[model samples]
Target: MVAGKPFERWRVAGTRRRGLTVRLIGGIIPIVTLSARQNAGRLRQRQEWQFFATTFRARPGLAGLWWGIVVLRGVLPAGFAVAMGVLIGAIDDGAPLVAPLALTGVIFLGMQVLGPIHMALSRNMGDQTAAWLYDRLTDYCLEPAGLGHLENPGLAADQAAARDFDLGQSAPPLRLSMGFIADGIVSFVSGVACALVLFGYVWWAPPILAGCWLATHWLLRESGIWRDRNTDEVRRAQQDAEYHYRLAVDPAPAKEIRLFGLADWVLNRFVLRRRRLHELQFEATRLRERSVLLSLAVVLTGNLAVFGAIGRDLVGGGLALGAAVTFTQAAIGAVAIAFGGLNWSLDSAAAPVAAVLRLREPMATAGALPAPSGPSCPSGPTGSSGRPGSAGPLTAQTGSGAGELRLRGVTFGYPGTGTTVLRSLDLTVPAGSSVAIVGRNGAGKTTLAKLICRLYDPDEGSIEFDGVDIRRFEVEAWRAHISAVFQDYIRFEWPLRDNVAPTGAPDDMVLAALEAAGAHGLADLDTVLAKGYPGGIDLSGGQWQRVALARTLVAVRGGAGVVLLDEPTAQLDARGELEIFSRVLAETRGRTTVLISHRFSTVRMADLICVVEDGAVVEAGSHDQLMRANGRYRTMFDLQAQRFDEPQEVGGDVLA
Candidate 1:
């Protein structure tokens, strides 16, 4: 009882000392000063760590298994060293070897088993995390009701960083780098455990060894390249290099490159840009020789001092041979805390994650549309523009079909460009009538079409539909009533049926639309549109244009009451354009149609023709009336007709 009392008192005293030490550490932590840049860097790192933690929430079971393996892997090195020492001690005492051998074998087996499992888990986790980031980016990009955000050049850097994060151009892909991060974590933990094990031999030796090993991180900064290489100049170089690489690889540029004999030029440019990128990275991350030497000296001194003390104790019979062996292994394992590629992998992984998170608010704000203002505005589920939906709140409440569309005092400019594309433009299309807008390039013809389609809103005007402001209706609900084919239409590498009827329509409807667009019999409905697929064939530019027209026709058949065609027949010759435009008029006889075109043949077919000049409608009339008036339209039409009648030299330049 008396002995127990003294032991209890000793325990209490030790607890008090530990508590006091913890308090002292807490006080010191608050007093440490950090520069503004350092604080920001630490905050960013913390946010990145938080993002990484959230990835585990997606698959709890797998995450649990991964964490278990990590713990086992971390402790196995220390456990193996202790087991070896135990076996040696048993052998020297002529004790049973079976128990010690079994322990050592178990630890060794854990090391082997946990390694592959850890690798697989890291790979899967990294892939899932990358997928999550992509989905987030997609949602953020599409969440806005307007196209302003997409056109903003200021956000391009963030977009590029997020998109190229897992592409292995800047750094190792997350899948491969994830394994490195896991290994680093395990190594760090193992080192700390080894240092703790050394505590039993000598109180002061563990701190000296651990401090020296950790000091290498501050001394050399060998991973500075990965940490600081995401600067603007570096990013621009990467972009330039990637562009050159793409020129060599992409099929779209292959013909031009071969025709122009630009292979050597492209290769040289790529090499130079890559070399410049390397030079910049090296300039940012170069190590100082003096710091390296100092780090080496410090580490060597600490290791020698610890080792010399252990040897002296063992040789003088103050320590057992088994104890000496255990301490020696711990001391060596403590070197795992030294700086290595872990920082490089970690910084690279965190950069893209941080970039993606940083863009959320800016992208959202840029793409946001003003709220519907009038008391009559209807609210409903936001449907997609390309897909059909049941009659929504806007239509159900207002009971308005496609009616006379009017633009009053409209002005607009693309985001991030100081130049205004449209200034106080005004025009009107009577209900169930066709109007063709004609103008020289850069005269706001396409801009007017975009405004009518509600892809963008004017800066200072109101667009009215059926005597009510268009903004009084929900964006998606209003878009449901219109179909459009832009000049730059998407050529989806999907089957013909899917391309024509992207949201699924009746076969008869699809066929009828295809026939109307002059796209029938071009290919089988099941045939893929790209040559890369088996049993697929490529189409000419004119053929693809017809396919785009058929897609718009399908949307019309699904109850859309308005049509917008922007340079829709540019790929077709004059005769083809006339024939296609005839079919289009027949198919959309009663629908309100707006066309933007440079071809006078297609323009003359419209019921009303408006000539745009300097961002305004300078002339409006029928083709005969315009010719009689001898206005801008007349001069443009005469010039085109005269060109067609005249023949030029074989190698002479042609108007585009």
Candidate 2:
């Protein structure tokens, strides 16, 4: 019985110790978790602040001046408070009023003078930041050798956000929001300085008052006043709103909106999208009742405690009137650090900055071309990476000759699409010769052209230049050798001369190229293409096609050895297309030429004709040779020939 009692007593004590240990751990877990969360938040804020600083550093001179002004503005508030107290003390003592009054007046004048200068500086810095960000965006978008990233659906949201951030639909522009950021920084500095001044009266008072005011931030966090609200929902809403707004404002859609009487519909859609975006943003960043009450309670308790102590000291004659007034002013100033506009303003500015930075790596990866499988060749004058912009004028290719082109066992498909656009295709174009390709729609003719241009590499097989794989050469160097007018060519809103020679050429050369394309005398060299500009005139569809051809011709004249015409004359009629092709052939007779067309009349003029079907070449011969063979080419040609006479079994296909 005695042994059992001892054992029972020991077991009971061990159980009690275990309970104590568990209780200690339970109590400590919340503290540790809260500390970790707070630390993480602080680290995030620090990183965001660093981004702002880096953006400011983009223009060092302007940023330095801006910082100088910020510090001066922050100090002015405390200076004004002290000067007021000193002037009052002078009055009470019957001392000379001139010096104290003059001091106070000087501080007030400094305060007034600094405001406008600060605003001007902020505006300039903000503009510089915008330019810096734009430069980075351009580099990321253009640095890639291929067009893959530009077409990726996954990056569309970030791209839109980065592109249109300054439009003020999703967030305030950096130009206006930067001033708010400055004000926030000044407020925090003023608060800390004022707390220091309060230390002169009572050491304990500053910590208690500062702690209470700072605590309000934590207590009122649920108010969502200062948090970043750039959730996925917000970004999606922003993109939708931006799309609707662009549809209403852009010139391309203006005609349809008015012609179809969709003006009201577009306007209503834009309004609804904007309203939805605003609603989502607000929902993410609206104040809550409980957080507001907690914040108010904390603030009230801190102010009352600090002020009541000051009152007691004054009434008991423990402190001088001047000191008491200064302390009171300091106490009021300390509240500047409490939850305010700075948090939200920072949020707005930081969101875009963070987004732009985050996109840099992924965008670069997306845009980058797959590494070449063959041995690398020495880059042409276009540099090692083969960036197209670095290429020299046509005069730079003085010694280069037209090279033979060949494709063997080539296969390709676009990203995210399950179907292949080109199968194991093979063809050869002898140097300085012309070959024309004819195909039904979706027969991979345009895709073949793009592959040859190296705008995309083949998925399998090889496109060779003079028996060497095209991938072995730098992309820009290979591209510099070829010029193309695509079916869907760009109509640059630049001047007529620029439209002919985007990278620039001699005036005589540009004029000759324009004349060849039947685009000469359409407009003046300096006339802008878009009607919105002064002295600008819009061209008809056929005129634009000629201009696009002129662009390719100019490249050919400069030194390009290969010419690709993919339905370049589609905007013109059959007669016009025949005339254009004759002129084009006359200009590019000696150079290698690849023409993709449906017009049998024009197709017959080529040195050799090839027909593509189901992503592979099914026939190859001359116009008469293919007709003699009575193959796919003959059938398509006969169908088109019979089109003007009688209705055929086939409806309108590419043959038509």
Best by TM-score: 1
Candidate 1 backbone clash number: 0
Give Cα distance to truth, residue 437, candidate 1, Å. 1.8
lDDT of 2 at 210: 85
TM-score of each candidate?
Answer: 0.88, 0.83
Model 2 C-alpha lDDT versus the unseen true structure: 0.81
Segments in model 1 whose C-alpha atoms lie over 4 Å from true places: 1-47, 222-225, 339-342, 378-400, 647-656
Question: What's model 2's lDDT at 232?
Answer: 74
- Residue range 1-656, candidate 1, lDDT tens digits: 98899999999999999999999988777666445567867764674575566466556676677667777788788888888888888888899999999999999998898899899889998888788888878888899988877778777777777777789867778888778878987887888778888989989998999999988887877644454466877767777777788898899899989999999999999999878877765574678899889999999999999999999999999988878888888888888888432566776787777777777888888888777876656653255554644445534443434468888989888888887888888888887789999999999998888788788888888898776677777787778878899999999999999998888877888899899999889999999999899998999999999999998988877666678999998999989999999999998887889999999988899999999987888899889999999978889998988887876556677553
Q: Which ten residues in a row have the lowest lDDT in candidate 2?
A: 384-393
Q: Give candidate 2 regions above 4 Å deviation.
A: 1-47, 222-232, 339-341, 370-400, 415-419, 438-443, 598-601, 608-615, 618-643, 647-656
Displacement of residue 234 (Cα, Å) in model 2 is: 3.6
Number of the top lDDT candidate: 1
- lDDT value, candidate 1, whole model: 0.82
Tens digits of per-residue lDDT, candidate 2, 1-656, equal: 98899999999999999999999999999999999999988876563665566566578778888888888888787888788888878877788999989999998999899888888778778778878888888888899888766766667777778887666777788788778888888887778778888888878888888887787777765553534355676677778888888898888799988999999998998899888877766664666678778778877887898899999998999977777888888889888878343567777777777667667888887767765454445444454222223344221433344667899999998765667999999999988889999999999999999899888888899998777777776676778778899999998889998888888778898889889999889988999999989999999989999999998888777667778999999989999999999999999977889999999999899999999999999999899999999999999999998877674455664432
